[model samples]
Every structure is written in C-alpha cells, then in structure tokens.
Target: MAENRSILVVGLGRFGSAVATTLDSMGQDVLAVDKDPLLVNRWSSSIPTVQADMTDVLAIEQLNAADFDTAVVAIGDSVEASVITAGNLLDAGISDIWAKSVSKEHARILQRIGARHIVNAETDAGNRIGHLVSGNYLDYIELEGEYNVVKIHTPTYLIGYTIGDAKVLERYGITVVGIKSPGHEFEYGSSNLVMHRNDELIIMGKQDQIDRFIKG
Candidate 1:
C-alpha cells in the first residue's frame, strides 16, 4: 500500500471539492479551505474545512501550508485568485504545488510562478475524447514530442503470427511492449510471443507509426 500524505486544498469550487474528497477517500489527510462560508459548510462534514481567503498570504500562513506534503490551487473561475493563492503557497514553502489552469496563458503563469504541476482539465479531456472517438484504441497517452502509448486489441491481420515472424518493429516501426490475454495477467512482449485474438497490446511509438500499424 502507498503511504498516506497530508494535502492542503485551496478553493471549494467543483474541481477543488473533487480533489479534496478524492484525496480523503485515498486515505490522505486533507485540509480543505475556501473563502465562501457556504462552500466550506457544504463540505465540512465530509472533510476538514477552514474558511479563509486563500488570496491573502496571512491566511495561508495561518493555515500552516508548509506542513502539508502537497498543495493544490483549484480556483478556476478567477485567474487572479488562483495565481495569488498559488503564490502564497509558494511563499509558505510548500514545494509540491499543483494549480488548475483555465487556459494556456493561465498555465504559463502558474508555471512561471513555480507551480510543480499544472492541471488543464478541459484541454486534457478534449484530447482524450478525440483519441477515443477514433475507435482504434481503448486508451491513449500522449508522451513528450512525437511519442505516444496506446492500449489496443491485436490487429486482425496479425492475430495468428508471432512477433518475430511478423517483423513488428522492422515492418511498422512500433513496439509491442506488453500484452494482456483475456482473463490472464499482463506479460512483457517478447519477440517469440504469439499474437492471439482477443489479446490486448500496449504499444509505444510515434503517432504516425501507430496509426499505420493499426490500419494494417
């Protein structure tokens, strides 16, 4: 099991509330803060709550933000409030700060303010939906530069061939790094591994190569 952590979550909007509740469910010690009394009251029974204006550095200090292992700024409606709250957390010496960004500019601002991670929820969801809509992949992950990783069923044309016989890498420029037979645990993809129908593959390669491989 993973070790539990102490997390400070500032803001009580949809994103903020979700983060706090999820962390609490995962056995993390979470202190949820917000400026609105109603927002704080709504979640007080569910998690630890502190009503305070997070934009105020003194308020952050009062909450002892630095003591938490991590902090998240989820004030998405107002960029000003979000930036101020994140900056205050930084001032309090919380090294691992994650901030929600409403736009590209907002993300850049958070990065410049020293936030360790920026969550662009809307943009990320859109990208994931675009990939899913294509019907080729069960799941997709975009990596740095041109690389991508995808989980997909073994293509029909390759169903009965072994990886060595098919010349997977030489022919398609993509790698089958892992395989999951239906009802069995996942295993590493070896060159001699035979491709079976209903088996799922975890493939890694450039997007174009993966696309072409899927088409075949």
Candidate 2:
C-alpha cells in the first residue's frame, strides 16, 4: 500500500517477473532475485535484480532481509523451493510474505511456514466457474457460509429504474444493491446509483434466490 516501502521479490519466473513489474509500476522499490544469471541480467534495469539460490541458507543470510519491508515468493514448479523460500523469509524476520501456490498441499505448506497471504490462480478460477453456472448470474462471491453478494447484468427489460423502485428484492427474492454502468469498473464503496441499459446491478441475498434471479 505504501509506495515508499521496499519489496523483495524471490524467483524470476513468469509469475515472479509479472509481480515485480507490477509493483515497480506502482512506484514500490523492488529487489528481484533469481538463481539464473541470465534472469538477473534480463531484468537488471527493469528492477534491481540479484542472482542467488533462495534455498541456500548462505544466499539468504548474505542478504539484508531487514532492509525489505515485504517479500513475495513467486517460485513456480518446485513447491519445495517455494515453501522453503517462504519459510526462509519468515525466519529472516520479514513479517509479510505473500506466496504463489501450485496446489492444495502447497497452499497448506505456505500457510504453515508463516506466509501472510497465498494466491492460487487455479482455485480462484474454479470458484468463478461455480458462480457462472449458478444462474444467468454475471458473478457471485460468498461473503461467508451464511450469505452471498452477487453482480448480475441488468436484462434489457429491467433497465431504467431506480434501485429501490426496481422491487427486485421483493419480486425476485434478491436485493438490487448497486448499479454499474457500461464504462464502470470497481466502484466498491459507491453503490447507490440508478440502473441503465448497459449498467450492472450488484445484489445480495441467499444463494438459491440469486440463482433463480439470474435464471429469470
């Protein structure tokens, strides 16, 4: 969140490169490390890169982990190395380590090693697939076991109505929470708006009712 905070990015694989580049673009100081010499050279100017095997205790010890505000373990293919890197960073007193996981086992191990956050591309997609088929649903996210907040594109017939006047909650058993316009993107805290032709409505209610609303 703080642009002034420095980040240590371990590994230089595709995922690692992308994450480092993204953070740098956001104005965060980054030290990108990889075992391959070529990898370090390739990204030298893109961000500060160091060539060192992260699994080696000496390599980790040689570096000043205290200088980094955060660490990201983006190692791919080898779950062992990924887990080890996360553990090493944790031991080095880097309190915030974000890890990229390959599988359920990898995710569990990363958590055990004190990774503060785990990002799994596969699991997130699988969760989205379940929501898509739940109905004509645009998207749905489970807030918890008890409730769900969903986004449904307004059908052409349902356009041109106020959120309260829509009566979607009473008629469809789903709340007409907020609307998104054709050009809208990620309006998180600002949701009180009217619906229009190309707008999207984000609603909340029981999952069963959400499915039915999307279907109708």
Candidate 3:
C-alpha cells in the first residue's frame, strides 16, 4: 500500500497540493499541513489537511516528524522560509526530505542545509514528458556523459535469432540490458534463449549510435 507509508507535505501551494492530492487519491495516508487555513480548505478532503505555521520550528515539531519517514517542502517564493522549514524537518529526525527549488543557487543552499532531494518541479516534469515522447528514449540518467538507456521494440530482423548469431553489440553500438517475454519463466539462461517477436528490449548506448541503429 503506497499511501500507508505516511507522507507529510508542508506547503499547500500548487506543487505541494498536487503531490498530496495525487498520493491521497492513490490510497496513501497523507498529512498536509499549512499555515493558511484557506489553503487547507482548498484541498477539499483529497488529503488529511491541517493548519499550522510550517516556518515555526516548534509548530513543525508538534507534527511529530519522527513518525513520518518522508516530508516534502514545497514552499514557493520564500526561499528563506523554505530552507528553514527543511532544516527543521531534518533536525526533527525525518529520514527523507524533498524540496522544490526556484533556482540553482537555492538548490545548492538546500543541498548544503541537508535536503536529500530537490526537484525543479516545472522544468523536470516537462523535460521528462518530452523525452518520453521523443522517439523511444526516456532521457538518460547517467553522469558519465556518453551513455543512455532506451526502450525499443525488438526489431523484426533480429527476431528468432540467438545471441551468438545476432551479435548486436558487435554489429551495432548498442547492447541489450534486459529482454521481456510475456507468460514465460524469468529464469531462462541467456545462452539457451533466443529473442522472440514483440519482445521488449532495454538497450543502452551512445545517442548518435542508438539513433543510427534505430534507423538502420
């Protein structure tokens, strides 16, 4: 049960409210606390709403941060308040803290002050959706600067071929990281298995090489 883990969203703005609503709608137990009762009212029973000044460390502490494993700080506009509230959440003994940042400098400050994760909210969502729509690539997550992960339908040319016969890595720059076959056991040895039609393949390689291979 995702909603049973307990989530605390401190700010009830657009971003925070969305997160809380989504989590609550999915059957998770969510506690949304905000300084503005009006903001709490606007959530409309989507989540367990409460009114409290998140900036006040004492008020935040009263929420029993130790009981919740993760807390999200979505304070917008007031960087200082957001950071302070994040710091309080950390000091109060929560394990994971995710904050929304407005800029690089603010993100760095939050990192230095101990936010475990920071999201760009607006840009990240757009970029992720854009990547999913761009060909079969879902955008690379690696930091080495030369590799990417992609999802592609197994090519008909390679179907019914053994790994030894296909030599995908030798012929193409990409390598198969995972292959999925429906209604079959997952323990099949690599040496004994051959690719089948409509199988899903997870491949990794350079962007240019992957593009060439896809088009080839």
Candidate 4:
C-alpha cells in the first residue's frame, strides 16, 4: 500500500475529476475544488469537494493550500484562470504544483508563475496513442528524448533462441531487462535464457533501435 498524502485539486473538469477520484480511491486525502456548485455536489459524496472560484486568492488562502503536500491546477480552458490559480497556489507555499496547459504559451506562463510541472494533456495523449497504434509493441513509455521502455511479445524468429544468441544488444542496441513467460511472473532476463513463443520482453533503448528490432 502507498502512504496517503493530502492533495488539493483545483477545477473539476474531466482531467481534474479523474485525478481527484483516482487519488481518493487510492486512500489519499483529496480536496477537490470547483466553481460550479453542481460539479462540487456531484463529487462531494465520493470525494471531499468544495465550491470555490480558484482564481480568487482569498478563496485559495481560505483553503489553507499550504497544508496539502501537492496541488493540481487542472483548468485547461481558461489561461487567465489557470495562471491566477497557479499563482495563488505558489503564494500559499504549495511547492509542488502541477498545472494543465492547452498550448505552449500557456505552459510557459505556468512555468514562469512557479508551477513546478506543466502537463500538455492533448500532446501527451496523442503521443501515447501514436505509440500504441504502431503495431509493434504492446506498450511504450517515453523516457528521455528518443529513448523508450517497451513491452513486446517475443518475435517468432527468436522463439527458441537464447538472449545472447539473439544478439539483442549488439544488433538492436536494446537491453532485455526482463521477460515474462506464459502463466509466470516476470524474471530478470539472463543472456543464456531461452525465450518462448508466448513470452513477453520488457526492453529499453532508443526508439529507432526498438523500431528496427521490432521490424526484424
């Protein structure tokens, strides 16, 4: 189980609501705030929520934002509202603040206003989808720049080959970090370990190298 932490989420749009509900489900102390009374009332039974305008500095101060370990400004539609809300959270001494941004300009503004993190939700979602639909891997997570950690089904050509014989590192520049055989838990992959058809490989490398490995 994870340790519970107090979180303040401003705005109750789809993104904000998802974050609040997920955190609440994980047994975290979540305070969800929105200007809409209807939205606040709807989530109040499941998660602690209050009807308050996030842009109002006094309302933010009243919430005692400093008490929460983290704050999320999930107001993507309105640049002014998002900026003001993020500024207020910073002023209240919330050191870890994440803000949703609709554009590059919005992201820059949020960073300039002391938001510790800025999420471009649309771009991230698009990139994730692009990776998922590429048809080579089961899942992909972008690391730094062009690197990625990918989960892939063992290719047929390597079905009976050992990791070293497959030359994954030499030929593809990818490291097989772990492998999961059918009906078994993942184990650290060794160079001499033979792969099965139903096995899944957890590998990490540059995206181009991963693509080349998958293509072969």
Candidate 5:
C-alpha cells in the first residue's frame, strides 16, 4: 500500500473542497481551511476543517502549515488571496506548495510567491478529455514537455509476437515499461515475454511517437 500523506488545504471553493475530500478518501490526513464559515461547517464533519482566513500569516502559522507534507492554495478567484496564502505557506516553511491559477498572470504571481506547482484545472481537464476521445489511450499522464506515459490495449499487430520480435523500440520509438494481464498484477515487460491480445501495455515516450505507435 502507498504511504499516507498529511495535507493542508487552504480555501474551500469547489476545487479546494474536491482536493481535500479526495485526499481524505485516499487515507491522507487532511486539514481544510477557508474564510467562509458555511463552507467550513459543511465540510467539518467529513474532514478536519477550520474557518480561517488564509491570507493572514498569523492564522497560517497557527495552523502549523509546515508540519504537513504538502499544502495547496486553492483560492481560484482572487490573485491577491492566492499569492498571500502561498506566501504564508512559504513563510511557514512548507516546501511543497501547489497553487491554483486562473490565468497566466495568476500563475506567474504564484510562481513569484514560491509556489512549487501551479495547476490550471480547465486546461488539464480539456487535455484529459481530448485524450479520452482520441480512442487510443486508456489513460495518459503528461511527463515533462512533450513526453507522456500512456496505458493502451495491446495493438493487434503485436498480438502473437514476442516482445523482442515486436521491435517496439525500433518500430515505434517507445518503450513498453510494463504489461497488465487479465486477473493478474502488472509485470515488467521483459524482452522474451510474448504479447497477448488481452494485455494492457504501459508505454512511455514522446507524444508524437506514442501517437504514431497507436496509429500503427
């Protein structure tokens, strides 16, 4: 099982609430804070929640923000509030801080305020939906720049071939990192292993290469 994380989430807007509840359900210790008492009260029974203004440095310090493994400033609408909250988290020595960005300007502000990650939910959701509708990937995760890790059903062309015979690297410029078989756990993709129609492949490569491999 994966190790649980302790997370501090500031802001109780839609995105913040979603993040907090998801983390809590994943068995992480989550503490949620928001300026709105109604929002706090609504979530208090589900997770540890407090009605506190995140823009205030003293309030953040009182929360012991640095004690958590990660902190998220999910204040989406106000750039000022987001920056101030992110700054307070930094001041509190919370190293891993994620801030929501409504626009490029907001993202730059969060970056300047020392937020480690800036998430643009709309863009991310659009990308995910595009991939899902493409009919190629079962799931996809963007790695750095143009690279991606993708899960796909084994291609018909490789159904009866051994991994070595498939020439995945040479033909597709992608690597098969692992294979998930029906009713079995994932196994490393060994060169000598034979491919099966029902297997799912976890591949890693540049986006273009993955596209080509899928098209073939």
Candidate 6:
C-alpha cells in the first residue's frame, strides 16, 4: 500500500473541493481551508475544514501550515488571491506546493514564487485529447523529456509473429512492456510471446520512435 500523505488544501471552489475530497477518500490526512464559512461548513462533515483567509499571513501562521509539508492552492479565478495564498504557504515553510494556474502568466508567477508544481487543467486536457484524436493510441501518458508510454492496437503486420521474430526493439527502438488480449488480463511482454490481432500493446519509447512505430 502507498503511504498516506498529510496535505493542506486551500480554497473550496470546484478544483479545490475535488482535490480535498479525492485525497480524503484515498486515506490521506487532509485539512481543507477556505475563507467562506459556508464552504467550510459544507465540507466539514466529509473532511476537516477551517474558515480562514489563506491570503493573510497571520491566518496561515495560526494554522501552523508547516505541519503539513504538502499543500495545494486551488484558487484559479483570482490571480492576486492565488499568488498571495501560495506566497503565504511558502512563507510558512511548506516544502511542496501545488497550485492551479489560469494562464501562462499565472503559471510563470507561481514558478517564480517557488511553487513546486503548477497544473493547468484546460491546457492539459486539450493536449491529451489532441493525441487521442489521431486514432492510434488507446491511451497515452507523457513522461519527462520526450519519453511516452502508449497503449495501441497490435499492428496487422505483426499479427502472426512473436516479439523476437518481429525484432520490434531492434527495428522500432521501442519496448513492448505488456500486452492485453481480448477478454483477458494484461500479461508481461516476452520475446516468445505471440502477437495476436486483437492484442493491445503497452509500448514505451521516445516520442519520435513511438511516432515512427505507430505510423508504420
């Protein structure tokens, strides 16, 4: 099992509420905070909540924000409030801060202020959808640099061949990590494993290599 985290979540809007509730469900010790008493009250039964303006340094100090090393600033509407809240978290010595960014400018400000992670939901969703629309990948995960992991339908040319016979890694510069056939669980990839027409392969490689393999 994964170790539980203690996270402080500021703001109670849609994004903030989602993060708080998800973390709470995952058995994390989550303390949700917002300036609005109504928002605090609404979530109190589900998770611990505090009604305090996070933009105020004194309020953050009162909360003893340092007790939780990780925090998320879910305030995406107002750039000023978001920046101030994140700044306050930094001032309180919270080590890892994740913030929501409304724009490139907002993201730049958060980065400049030492926020460890910034998420722009819309931008990310758009990019993911763009990849899926190509009809090649069943799913895709982008990793650091140019690396990617993708799930794709087994190519027709390889239907009757094994991994070794196809020389997949030698020719394509990508590894077939796992394969899932119709009506069956995923199995680890091996040199002798036969490629079936209906199998879905989980491949890992650099972007250019993946693109070439997919196009071929």
Candidate achieving the largest TM-score:
5
Steric clash pairs (candidate 5): none
For residues 1-216, write the lDDT of model 1, one tens digit per residue: 123567888888877787777566545678989999999999999989999998887887788888887888888889999998999899888878878899999999999989987888675443442353234678788888998899988898899998889899999999999889988999898998888988999999987798788778
Which ten residues in a row are the worst by lDDT in model 5?
Answer: 126-135
- Residue 216 error, candidate 1, Å: 41
Ranking by lDDT: 1, 6, 4, 5, 2, 3
Q: Which runs of model 1 end up more than 4 angstroms from their true locations?
A: 123-216
Off by over 4 Å in 3: 1-3, 126-216
Which residues of candidate 4, in runs, are more than 4 Å off? 124-216
In the range 51-82, model 6's lDDT, one tens digit per residue, is 99999888988998989858888886799999
Clashes of each: 0, 0, 2, 0, 0, 0
User: Candidate 4 clash total?
Assistant: 0
Residue 102, candidate 4: Cα error in Å is 0.4
Each candidate's lDDT (Cα)?
A: 0.82, 0.72, 0.71, 0.80, 0.79, 0.81
Each candidate's TM vs. the true structure? 0.60, 0.57, 0.59, 0.60, 0.61, 0.60
RMSD of each: 12.4, 12.9, 11.9, 12.2, 11.7, 12.7
Superior by TM-score: candidate 2 or candidate 4? 4
Q: For residues 1-216, what per-residue lDDT tens digits would candidate 5 score against the true structure?
A: 123567788888777887777566545677989999999999999988998997887887788777887887888778888888898888888888877899998899888878887888676543442353234568778776778898998887788787789899998889999999899988998898777887889999987788678667
What lDDT, from 0 to 1, does candidate 5 have? 0.79
Clashing pairs in 1: none
Task: Identify the superior model by lDDT, candidate 4 or candidate 5.
Answer: 4
Regions more than 4 Å wrong, model 6: 123-216
Deviating ranges (above 4 Å) for candidate 2: 1-3, 123-216
